[model samples]
Target: MLTITLAQADGSWENPEQIRGAVAAFVKAHLPGNAAQAHVAVQGPAPGLRFPACRQMRMGFFGYSNPYGNQTVAVTCTTPSAWTIYIPVQLVMNQAVVVAARPLGAGTLLAADDLSIIRRNASNLAGSAVVDPQLAVGQVLRFGVAAGQPILASMLDAPEVVHAGQEITLIAEGDGVRISTIAKAMENGRPGQTILVRNSSSGKVIRGTVDQAGAVLVPF
Candidate 1:
């Protein structure tokens, strides 16, 4: 089993057992298959975690190595009650294997398929309220440093939808007037392109151009 050591960043611990239990629960809920790969070791002073708490979370393959040797990512809680944790999968993996015999290397920009790559890619936050989830593979996600930050992710690419009766600016202005019109299903118009906007109330389809803001404008 891979041993995951949970330590405070500033070196303090309030309750080591509580931290360990939280980590264990998070792993069971998110990564059931990879439970055997984890063995948590808590070492630090009492009253650990001041601004935020931390817990060493792990799953799947638990072997990370580099010139600094093997290191597991710790799920950190910025506050004692906030329910979010920054999962830095790509960053930790890349740093851990930088000078190793086989480097993990940097990955491509996050897209809609790398969710699973972040399940165990976090560091810090064990006793706090932030509960980590099992991310999917090939899923798109965005991240940054700083405590309690949000990492946005999405699986499917959705198209923009436009409703009828809303006033929209048009790109094609023949006689000035700024070409404003009510549109229906014409929300699919491309910028600087002409499209047909059907008025929801009148059921009239007027031709107009899409403005820089993607709004369809039609002059009366």
Candidate 2:
């Protein structure tokens, strides 16, 4: 079992560094793994402001949220003469993430040469980011990304494998029967995207899911 205690932090009087240290310790203790280091930053108010310290200082989360990102936590004295104060904390966690190798323009397709894995402060990463290179390769970017910036999920999109007026094999399944015929695509779409396809025999427009092999799957 892992346990930590900060010395000379008894609640006789509030100490600024101790308060910060206690939060830092709390962040480190709450972190998931040893691969990332948690650096707690207590924001707002003067750290040197003196408050009546109780018998013992304890660290607690401000709410039900996990202690990550920008969060608020309570530093309370849990002994005789209880006093609790809320402090804003930002946990700067360092972890590995995928980043762009160079400045990538909008609509650029992701390739192995254009990406690299790098360790960065997780707090600085916005929203969510792509961790594996395989998950990003062949995907098209919807927006321009700066070099060395984390490749976020919102920044990339799947490229269309089939284009409008393109010829493909249309497979229709119904009543435990399968039929295949050559058809022309009426709209552009990527794998698994539903698009309109025109049957070459009857010229009827129908919607189907585009497969990776450039085949349209339709269920009747």
Estimate, for each residue in 1-220, the C-alpha lDDT of model 2 and write its tens digit: 2123445446567667767776666666676664246777777437556766544677777775454477776877665546777778777778778999999999999999999999878675666778898899999999998999899888888898899989999999999999999999999998989999999998999999998888999998
Q: Looking at model 2, which ten-residue stretch has the lowest summed lDDT?
A: 1-10
Off by over 4 Å in 1: 1-172, 218-220
Q: Against the hidden reference, what TM-scores do the models get?
A: 0.22, 0.73
- For each candidate in the order shown, give its overall lDDT on alpha carbons: 0.37, 0.79
Give a tens-digit lDDT track for model 1, residues 1-220.
Answer: 3333445544443354554455444433333242334343323223533334444433332344221122333544433333322221221211110011121123323333222122332333221111222232232222232222323232211222333445554333555544344446554644555567776566777777565565766555
Candidate 2 residue spans exceeding 4 A from truth: 1-22, 29-36, 42-45, 54-68, 76-79, 174-177
Candidate 1: how many backbone clashes? Answer: 33
